[model samples]
Target: MSDPVQLATARELAAAGSVRDTLLVGQRGGYAVRFKIGAGERTLVTKSGSPRLFTGIDAAARVLGGLGIARYRVDSSGLAEEDLPRRRRPDRAVALKRTHENAAYLEFLQQRAEAGRRDTVRYTDEQVNERMRTLRTGRRA
Candidate 1:
């Protein structure tokens, strides 16, 4: 097989009708586009020389459509639908729960502080300590 073609070159070839037939092949990560140019098949690759991958069939179709190539064959026999990677964020869920809990606790503490500020009564440190001792002992200080 000949070397893979970059997206720009592929687009030009597709627009010029040099790409006789297009095939969408399902790969490990995503769908790859293979073009039948002359008698050889060429895979679409990125500028970095890696096989270009599309997240889904629709995406690949849209790209091919933009290149003026419509009507392509899909070979999904290699695709393992269940094996596709899924987005998961268990850490994010735990972090969000902790964030909400912290916010609620902060609000509760703020309300208590505000109530204390609104009260006319005040006590010195020694008086407060004595009051705490009396409360602990269940006796007058």
Candidate 2:
């Protein structure tokens, strides 16, 4: 989204290898790019014929191509959703596992909640306004 970030990413891709080796570029409804860096995966998407997106992509591709890192390509057939790696979904087992891991913290939170209810403070409207004024103006209301 940010120019610097996009450029940095392009540079990384360029450094990795040839564009043809690193990127799976396609064009269908729009432009789609799929690539992986380490274990992290990313996809860059731009609407077909979008001036801004095209300009940015072109610049990036030119820089990368000039550096001999990658080649950009456009294909009529786009990447299939099923071909992309699926994100891991946390199920009930995961929730239970996390709850078990945080058991002590959960108990502490429960205790704190009980204590908070027992120690509740009921302030007069003027007292509340005074506190708010102090917070706002950094002086006694």
Pick by TM-score: which candidate is best?
1
What does each candidate score in C-alpha RMSD?
A: 6.7, 19.0
lDDT of each: 0.89, 0.52
Highest lDDT, which number? 1
- Which parts of model 1 have CA positions greater than 4 angstroms off? 87-141
Q: What is the alpha-carbon lDDT for the whole of candidate 2? A: 0.52
Model 2 TM-score on a 0 to 1 scale: 0.29
TM-score to native of every candidate shown:
0.60, 0.29
Model 1, TM vs. native: 0.60
- Look at candidate 2 and give me any clashing residue pairs: 17-69, 18-69, 18-70, 19-70, 19-71
Stretches off by above 4 angstroms in model 2 are 1-5, 16-20, 28-30, 44-63, 71-75, 79-141
Ten residues in sequence with the least summed lDDT for candidate 2 = 47-56
